[model samples]
Target chain A: MNKFGIVMLYSILLFSNQIFGQFNALEKGVFSGSFESISQWYQDDNKIIVSVPQDKWATNNYLSLHYTFGKFYAGLQYEAYMPPLLGYSRKFDGSGVAHKFFSYRGDFMEITVGDFYEQFGSGLIFRAYENRQLGIDNALNGVNIRLKPSDFFSLKLVYGKQRKYFEESNGILRGLDGDLDIIKLFKIQKNIGLQIGASLLSHYELYTGADPLFPPTVNSYSGRLDFNSTRLTLSSEYVFKESDPLDLNYFWYKTGNALLLNAAYASNGLAMNLSLRRLENMDSRSERTATDTELMINFLPANTKQHKYSLANIYPYSAQVMGEIGGQYSVFYKIPTGSLLGGKYGTKLNFNYSVYYGLDTTFLGGTQGFESKYFAYGEELYYQDINFELDKKWSKAFKTVLGYMNQRYNKAQVDGGDYPIVNSDIVFFDFLVKFPKNRSIRTEIQHLSTKDDLKSWVAALIELNINPSWTIYAADMYNYGNAGEKVHYYNVGTSFVKNVHRIEISYSRQRESLMCVGGVCRQVPAFKGLTLNISSSF
Target chain B: MKKVRIILLVVSVLIALGNQSEAQTVLPNVMVESITGQEVSAMNFFNDGKPMIISFWATWCKPCILELDAISDEYDEWREETGVILLAVSIDDERSLASVKTLSAGRDWPFTIYLDKNQDLKRALNVVNVPHTFLLNGKGEIVWQHNSYVPGAEQELYEEILKLTENK
Candidate 1:
């Protein structure tokens, strides 16, 4: 066995008791936790042909508990995947305590031992976190310390190994961060604010390869400045990394860097924001061989809107970490209640546009990656989005929303597939009507038009809510524009909720699509199944 | 085979539900960000002198939007009657965080909003779902809590808020 495997075994052996040992008895210290279980039983059909499970029943369950006594806190997590569900990585076949941490906080200093999650400024250079839906947890298993002597400045230092699929990666990571509030240091009590921060992170993996061009250690640093007033705010961060090659980048030994700028202005009835980002071979990972979303050291924030509707989510955008430049601008305006545009109640409108293009570069044959010019926009179009929506309340019991979206996506260029370019248009109409004591109904109809890829699709949904207890929803999606075959994906679900607990059961025929939550995308395979989800905390 | 899977799932769920006696809610001392992106402690706002109503919501959650909108219509009245403040905690990560402010402001929600971009506060508070509401007493003890949102759920929250202040 490898050294990292041995260390992982020891960690599990030492903390198995905390995870398995649960008591109903009362104690001095407060204990709290939450449990979530999502399970599916598949019934395969000729349509939506995909991999059938070796295990007919697949379940993913996570249980977390925490104990707190005064100023000290300790927590542990246990995740069980009786073999993983479809689309989830095979590395998650086993179950164990995935995370554990112990922490202490004093007046001026704090210390944490064992496993923990940390993020530097805007997470441009280093961020270790966990996202359950996306099946990502890169928490560092090591020691972290923080100090603040006199409130003028605060400092943080972290050293550990990134968690790679329930085991430690074969890399050692160390980082330091410091933040200073210029306004606070000067004791300015005005509404304006100013802060500056810097972070430095480095990771070294023992790569005893024969190639001399490969570097064992890669270092990166970032600096940021943020300023804000009551009306306007501006923030900018830049990251620079030393030469490092990885399996994803095809082992190209070139320097990597990223720059991000954000600005926002808010008034009484209007809000506007802008974000710009440029990435140049900035894929940083703890494990050299890690691909897909594993062992990521930094997350490139996708500069685009997160669409919630089904038709809108068909072409969600993920940032191209290798090289790309993109920007997003959005404006939200609230029309006056008595104005002409707004009937009795005020109207809300939002307009957003974002686009990305490849960086102009020429690949230099071998160990060296490529060469690029600054501020050069290439002719290669990666993605484009133009969407707008208007929401209005007609009466105390009636509301309506309308949305229109135009999207252009290059599947071969961006997502690394050999499909042709896809240009799509989507429209959404939503309505909500209220009835007598504690009853409401929501309805949505959406349509998408496209000639390439999945062709065209349409969906309709209706949800009924009875206050304080139950909700029932039914939805259907039909691929009418597909020339080969036509399929109707349908789902019927009901949810029962009580004080701090919820249970849901659904029968769904899901089509293949990318589920994007918070700009992160995960591809869920097509399946026809019965699913159950339950969550509770106490 | 299907029957066996169903039986196993039902058994496990029942075993989990059998231990639901105590329901004490305390804010874990995790740090989150305000709407302006400033770091603040979770325990500070929910434990103020007045009765506090802490609601967990997200930008993309439709049920969360319905719940918050339902409450906003009567928020002024609720606050006037019971000196309670509604603290909306959004569990939007970097992906959808940019929309929280615009959505909330466009809807004219009159509540102090904070961002749980990393979900630190949500994990610590054991909130696995959005639209979860927690009512706290003046002393910062959790008085009542509810999960999910139906149209008339705000009535229960109002009644619980009244009960909390009345008990005090």
Candidate 2:
């Protein structure tokens, strides 16, 4: 046996006979789940969901087993699903368990080998991880080491391969990151603090395709700096990478060199954020391969507000890691108690606006036939948005929020292909009423207007909260414009919960898109049906 | 068309009602082939009654390559002590699978090799990228999983394997 192997074997035996001694009765069991019929009726064909079995099954049904003793943790899972009934996929017909190995020895560090998720410096240059409900898992199949030398400083280093669906890619990925909280480290500068970080990642993969100009290796580097004080805060970060023509392209063209810059500031209840991104053609994947949204060495956090309601999140913005220019500004204020606008309970007002437009082409200068790293190839802004919200409390039992929004989207960029520009105006109002004891009711009304697509829409929602254990929710979204486009979507749901366990049941006729968090994403076709969910952790 | 719709709906409703066995809903099985001419199947790995470690990787993935290189030195010991079976599967696609043999021989990897030529195994695992690993117990059921890699993570895996296989 190899030296490393020998060492590992001894370590296992020593810990086995020493730590656990015996398996706990709670650790043994056969866990399973099944979902034979799932229908997503909003698409053109009924077999849509069947084609992507893993996505459908992971979203619908699966089973996992977990057990732990002392410092050791282990888990296993089996996934099996039938063909999708509606807009789901049929090809996802396999199951495999994901494993995790974690070790925590005092304050030195905690390590996880095999498959693990990590984010460094806001995940600008590299972030590999998962968000199940979003169906996204970009876990690295390798090793991860974290060190916390002191309460004020932390360090992390990771190396491995990116996971593509169920398999690992052939390319290599390695990164090193360090974070130092200056204030805590110094002790005296508690209120006034600073933080700094840097990361370097290299991916080595040989060119396999017909592209002649591509290189066999690529490198990416990122750095961040931040300062925080009781009354003021500022943060700045930058990312850069070596150019590879074959892997970075968006409209069937070679990508160019790239770079990005971001800065933000805040004080009291007021904060402001600004960012300037200039990407020539920066797309990094494990196999140097590109899908709609995979293999990104950097993450673009939407500076714009993240919408919660379905309509607001409908045309959610995706950071253009290729090439784009944009900025954001926001202001917030809280009225003092006992004022007219505050209405004896105080009021809050917030305003935000953001715009994204095409960059000028003059910045990139290339050869006669060769592409430049910077160019404004397309016309029209990818997206633009603005919003304002006001919250007021009339009494201990009553509180409300009113908001307005305006947005513009270029059909060609996000949704793919050119159509027409999208212009929309929206208004919304929500109220929360508390009754005697632990009872509360929340209601929301929203209206949206646009000239293209659906034309106009109206939505209403009502929710009841019985503190400590139960919640009932109901809502409907109605499209009032466009002859046959007028569709009524409604949902009524209830939840029963206690501590770590929760059970939810709902019936609905809904029109919506599926969303994945982290780096995993899949379209969730619309459906009209009943659903049940139960989750518990021990 | 009307008849087809009715049939589909009826079938869906019936299936939903009869699927109480807790066996109908599962992520699809993703198959991968190894350079050694072994057909690595995910179905056989599920809930197999032994602690299993399946590492999804490729020859070109730099981090993955490094991770394997780092673990190879200790893998044998881990197996001897915990009886953990580590399956290293490659998703090199059809065009690149030809080079798998050369690469594995050059690196001298000791674990069992499997090839996922068509990437059928990757999609079933809900993997959007590479270098994902899954851990399973004696029943072939997945217990825990992690994505991405950092240095010194293999030691952590051994820790879990020991805890899992000790009393068995």
Candidate 3:
């Protein structure tokens, strides 16, 4: 149906809540939904060399509605991208109903038909999900069934075609996952937990190529184990994929495998966590020709800390889906409130270290691809980061946060460039002061020094917040030591939020950068613009 | 042209149907993981007969951490007064899921935390952003909710809780 028809149908269903409400028997049914829109007006600036498209004004809008009555539930999402934002994919150029689903939940089982998202253990082998900010919604359009025959055992079955932009991919996917909780099944009296799960997934696509050696069907299997206690947790997952030729791997018919291990220990005031991962030819996609965040059947998130500061994000790392080896270790501690260093409110500290490297392999230059030892480390370093932060609250109205980070980024491997490795150091200080009558101000200063890439930089921000409703902020980032034209990226914005609604307006000079969320990265083009964001839930 | 006419007709019919339907108050029934990796229904968060707070947060969200830290200071008192329970739901995907326990433990937060690993519960609840909190009454109805957090906003939340208790 067209956009208008879909809107009409949505409005009808929305108002039907009241129609059903009038009937005493159906009055208990409920309706809930949310709406979000982001619009931007682009302006050209010669200094930054921005490329403004024909449509200077762009917006992305989404409206989702859900209804539930006892064991039955249904929902649909409508999305509109008026020519789409500059950085967004070109495929998302129109508006339509992107998702619709219906489901029923019974005592022992639940079944859903239509669009749905699901994930296997740790999402190493199969994951169908969405991230609006990243412009990714790979929900499957088929049947999803969850069967819980017993309290300790559950099984899930899925069969569908993955969503690719506004349409479904040509490939058909089928998956089954079963999980068993030994502790619960045996009714163990100890204060511990143990679970084991296994998954099997297969993808089928027609092969029209002349090469008969290409396999039209690819299958993968994964197994996982999880153990947890009051103060310690351990989990691991291993996946193996059959030899399948695809575009991402240059049509190589090499098998793929991945192994991930995680361990964590936490007590009253101290905690530590460590994670390790290895990937070998693990780029598993639904479509053979899919590229750049399209029709993916698995997830491999980078095992690195996600820094919150803008300066710290300049060198963010993206997980290498093909082959990589890395791990991260972190520790968090809180000083006692009465200690000398803790003063009155106790001090919080965090330390983290992470590193990644290319796989040690010997290229065979053929379909068989390469060979590598299981425990060998590659000679090329992809990325390394070490960071520390301290948070302290001195009094009722004063607080401060200090942090430092050292990073080594390999532009050649991570971003697909041949530039030299960039080494940088960053330090930041943030202070907040609260005034009477629900008023507060926060300020931050950050400096990043580097010998490569764009050289040294500095940034500052100040924000004023007025009680439960309004906030205003202004920030600037300047490349002070640039060998070329020294540029300053500045932004000013304000936001007003009420019960369930929020509206924000901002004007900024956005530099070309990679915006990432949970290791998924997207490149945003440089442009000066005025932007408006509105969101509400009901 | 015909589509516009049909849309108008539907709009009028919707107006006639009215917009007075009650909003959803009870939490959706979705499976989420406990801190110990056990799948628990989101509906099980309902306390027998006490107020409960459901706060959505992430480890990387600074505002969410600030809000939780602010509440942690006086959580014991709030519990003693209104018999309230707080459930912090971390919408951290697999990338940062391993840190939720360590961070919560390190900060000494006195509240039950759950992991919405794949965001099933997050999507069902229509939560578009972090630091979103819902206040439920003794009967498990969402009495009040707010999005975003500013310093001192916890006082306003406490006032809402006080009102709920006073009404009781």
* CAPRI class of candidate 1: acceptable
Order the candidates by TM-score, highest first. Answer: 3, 1, 2
For candidate 3, the TM-score is 0.97
Q: Candidate 3 vs. truth: CA RMSD?
A: 2.3
Tens digit per residue, CA lDDT, model 2, B1-168: 423433443343234324312221222333343332223346656434668887888754644754675576577787777777777877653213323443443344566668764454554454434566667778776665545443345555666777788866
Error of 3 at A97 (Å): 0.6
Residue-level error in angstroms, candidate 2, position A272: 4.2
**Where does model 3 sit among the CAPRI classes?**
medium
TM-score of chain B of 3: 0.88
Per-residue error for A134 in candidate 1, Å, reads: 1.4
Reference-based lDDT, residue B41, model 3: 89
Lowest lDDT block of 10, candidate 2 chain B? B20-29
- In terms of DockQ, which candidate is stronger, 1 or 3? 3
Interface RMSD in angstroms for candidate 3: 3.5
lDDT of 3 by residue, B71-107 (tens): 9988999999999889999999889999999999998
Name the better of 2 and 3 by DockQ: 3
Residue B85 C-alpha lDDT in model 1: 90
> How far is A301's C-alpha from truth in model 1 (Å)?
3.3
How far is A148's C-alpha from truth in model 1 (Å)? 2.8
